[model samples]
Target: MPIAALSDLAGKAECPLLVIKVGSALLVGKEGVRREWLTGLVAEIAEARARGQQVIVVSSGAIALGAATLGLDKGGRGSLADAQACAAVGQIALSGLWAELLGSHGFTAAQMLLTLEDLEDRRRYLNVTATLTRLLDAGAVPVINENDSVATQEIRFGDNDRLAARVAQAAQASAVLLLSDIDGLYDRHPKEPGARMIPVVEGVTAEVKAMASADSNSGMGSGGMISKLQAAEIAELAGICLVIGNGQHDRPVARVTGEGIGTLFLPCRKASARKAWLGGRLRLKGSLVVDAGAAAALERGSSLLAKGITEVEGVFERGDPVAIVDGAGQVLAHGLSEYDAAECAAITGMHSSEQAAVLGYAPRSAVVHRDQMVLK
Candidate 1:
């Protein structure tokens, strides 16, 4: 199977992790959780594991399933609260279904619900990563979904595609299989008469971007071709191959992997995924103003030092992500802070030796460690 072979090509030092993202449309049919389809997918996953692969599933449809149980209108939830309530109820069904099916196939299923902040915060990112590593080591499959019940932002609009990419990076996965309702990327919409499928993508260029449509093919899922393309971009940056295939077909995952029935995007990533994430995201909790020397050192792959820092500009806790800015207002790098805002303010201009005197306890010395930072 192409999906199974992809990891052998990457040759990860540890057992290769593979992520499968199932959208709401395929997961929740008119009756509720689509048991027949899910059972087949789990069977394929079990087969993959028998061949020494670790799989994680990122799924959507909590709200849809919950809405069905709650007797809400099929059109959409009336309010965000209603949607959240539905998710709180639906997540149980979703997780239980996965557990039941995977158990039947002799695999333990671990369920997790994550919010955006969980991955954005370095501290939380490490915790999640550690937990995933442990689970994989124990030979269990993880079933994950966005924490819709507590999502403050508008409910997940097929963000699971992107979330799948993030999970792949966090778990150091070699590939992601996004099982969708459509056949995969084409020259135009699949329904169009002359549309042609593109088999492999070395990179996501403008032409590739133009091929995607804003609307989803799956009437039930929020993500469309656009979301899948975005996911491909993230996977590319993280050096993880991502495939989009039609999951509605019988024994879908098996057919896609064995017959190579999907669009495969190759990866060309160079940095640690955590660092790539720090560089890619736009939201920074605060900025640390450093001198010219610090800026040059950062560019040459050095850590942020307290002695070079000139000022601390926003309130942030230790382990929160922040930007390292130069004197001229240019952002040099981004990284996780080792100290809180007040502590940073007090130690901004001090040397490593002097920090112990002011801080009462010895510190880690650098404001941000090189391993935790990514240069712009």
Candidate 2:
């Protein structure tokens, strides 16, 4: 299907949240920031916001700009220290330029830098999600990048493609767009005589990955077709469609709708918000074994109450994900706990009103609210 009319894809959600990834090649040049390319793209982003869509920009170019400033070769096997130095220097210019450009258009640019550890930790992940949600709610555009300056090789994502995917998943975004040097996936090397660009991919299968093996590096960028495909896989699992397109042309965001030079990877079905919340996204801290009455209430779409809890297994703080298990030891659901393991252990099987009296503090009514739980 020629989705040149992206509304078809976007219609999947009202007030759709979109993640846009700008590669280093598109953002950096020998002369420095590509003012023309970025200005035009920012214009599209501005229009998109005016049209009521929430947009997040995941950008690269810190290392490239830093290399230029420090007289280092990014393409070479530079030491991690040298790379970090470049990121430190370039990040200032990168974030400032984005803020300036978006500011000129009456939009605020919120800068966020993240490392693998931030997304991997359950608590930090939720914190990041909250910040992003608030930024979007306040009508600010979030420009995020990898925290290369403080990140070690072990903790780094290495490529922003995966970073963008993880961030989009965390935000529970509706779609992701990777704007790069190439238009989209090709049947073979793009320069081949008859190689054709596949317009739409329903799912990321072995054949799709084989096609991605032909790298689409633009010399200055780190991610290629392989990395984009890896990103598509993440989007697929998150029930988010991803679009790959060339940002070299005018009105590049137009390509996101399946128009212009772009390819759309659509997920088979949309995953529920509950699944995205507790479905392997948040790392579980522990499990709470509840009595039969509590288990029945949970299945009936009720919140987890402290009075029904029989056992608390695991050392988890409040707001951490914990599984709810039945008396038979069968897993029932996963939800965020309102109380710490110690507190829950102490207040187990007690009424909610008794908690404040016993613990000398007023706690939320539910141990694990129904809204937070993903029932099995």
Candidate 3:
């Protein structure tokens, strides 16, 4: 298929939520912030906003800028403490520049610092999603960066590429644009003779992954081509398209706006916000084995009832994710269990009316409500 048109895409139903990730190399240089590039980027942002699009930027360069300000080697020989110090100082520089530039374009730049926990925890995830939505509704562009000042190796996203994917997924963005030093994905390293750029990737299969195996160090940014591909995989599963393109060109955003300027990774399918959060992209805590009748009901768009469950496997509390399977061992749907395993065991095969009698209280009738399930 021909690459999707960016202008046409910007008019889609979900286009209001567009996430653009700017890499460190493009945003920073030996002198610190790249002024000319920022001006061009701001112009694009102005155009996008005028078109009624709500833009979110996942930006890198905090540590690099911080290191530069401290007279340290960029992205090299920095201890964790030094890195954290750099981030603490650099965030101010980054956000200040963004605020000033965006303000010049008659836009407000809202800064957000995030850690992996913000996206991993259920409560925090909902909060982040709500905040982003509210910011967009209020006509402010949110520029997010990882909270490197406090993040340790074990808790860090390690790269803004994956962080951007998570942000796009949670924000229910129509698409993600990754503007980097390189133009797009290639058959092999672009530095190698005869290597060809792959204009579009419909799926991230094993073959597609193999092409990204080479180390991705851009010298200034933490992510390489491998990280971009990994981020693409995350976006694909969340049903969000991802675009990777060169951000060094004049009118960087306009370049990607044209046809074939980048590699677009199309989503496998569109998934609803509720379904994506319920269990479509999560790890299940347990499973419910139901009879064929219940499986058929599920396929017919019915909720999972306690009376339909034959067995429960694994230990899980109420509100935890669980897999629903058929008697023949076919996975049907994934959802949050309304009751803990103990309560479920007591209420198994019981009618809805019997739930309160057996468990002393019934918060909900369905073991997994239709609204909380995503059919596999």
Candidate 4:
């Protein structure tokens, strides 16, 4: 189907929940918080909530506001610690603005800052989902942002675009609206005369990829068109439709929700909840190397058998997450290990049928069950 048609269908349907990601560029201008733009966005969100549709906002503006407030040079001359400190100062002001705007509409806004580690652990992921679900049920809008104040390079979400996609996957959102400075994804940078908007993208193909330009010259923020495309791919894999459009447009959320603007990316395939969690949520703690035949079997959707194991690296408990690597040292996939590191080492190269004898107790036939495996 054409993307416009799909967007029309989505807008007309009674979508239960919507995830909107507002970029920093739209939130902060040369002066300060773009009150006019923010006011419109809040109004739209309020309208949506009044219609009984839940909304979760993944917003980016802390660093920009921090830069402005501290009178520091934008996007330069700041160490990681400096930026973290700036975020710490700006977060308070940012939340205050949201609270005031939401308050006028007879609604309340709650702040939620997350790091990569929060979603990497299974228990934490479940807890986050439950909390957000409860907030939505209570008619409260959750304003989410990356925990930049304490986040290090190792545990950051990298960019708000990807973070928004992950949030949509965790919340099981119906669609993700990525509001940016640009109108939509185009054949090239929109500044060029010949650049044309590609309204519908069936998939992220090589041809579509070649059309992308690495022209993220924005000094105020890190994300650009490339990051937005990556977020679309992530959301598509998780069976959620994604739309990228200009946040500066009047009534941005309402316009997109009404099928009047932006580029729409259709979902390719729907992944199961367990598989999606296994694929995107878990952080790898160790790796298991396998031979070519074993890699082939895994690619064919088979489970990891002990006979195919070659070696293990790193220390991980039985329920810990591990990476499946090929003999050449390329990561094939990730899964929760069924045995401890020592047990897996002892049973390497043994037949799966003999697992019970080698370990003195068999847990399951496969080392990594098919249901627990996600192909990378």
Query: Highest lDDT, which number?
Result: 3
User: Which lDDT values do the candidates have, in the order given?
Assistant: 0.81, 0.81, 0.83, 0.79
Better of 1 and 4 by lDDT: 1
What is the TM-score ranking, best to worst? 4, 3, 1, 2
lDDT of 2 by residue, 9-31 (tens): 34424436889999988888778
Model 2 superposed RMSD (Cα): 8.1
lDDT of each residue in 163-237, candidate 1, tens digit only: 898788788787888988887899888787999998888777778988898777656666888889888876776
Per-residue accuracy of model 3 over 267-326 as CA lDDT, tens digit each: 766557666655434346788999888989999999999989999998999888889988
Best by TM-score: 4
Give the alpha carbon lDDT tens digit for every residue of 40-105 in model 4: 989988887776778889988887788777877754227787778778888898888998999899
Q: Considering summed lDDT, which 10 consecutive residues are worst modelled in model 4?
A: 1-10
Clashing residue pairs in all predictions, respectively, total 0, 4, 0, 0
- Candidate 1 TM-score, true structure as reference: 0.74
Alpha carbon lDDT at 65, candidate 4: 83
Provide the clash count, candidate 2: 4
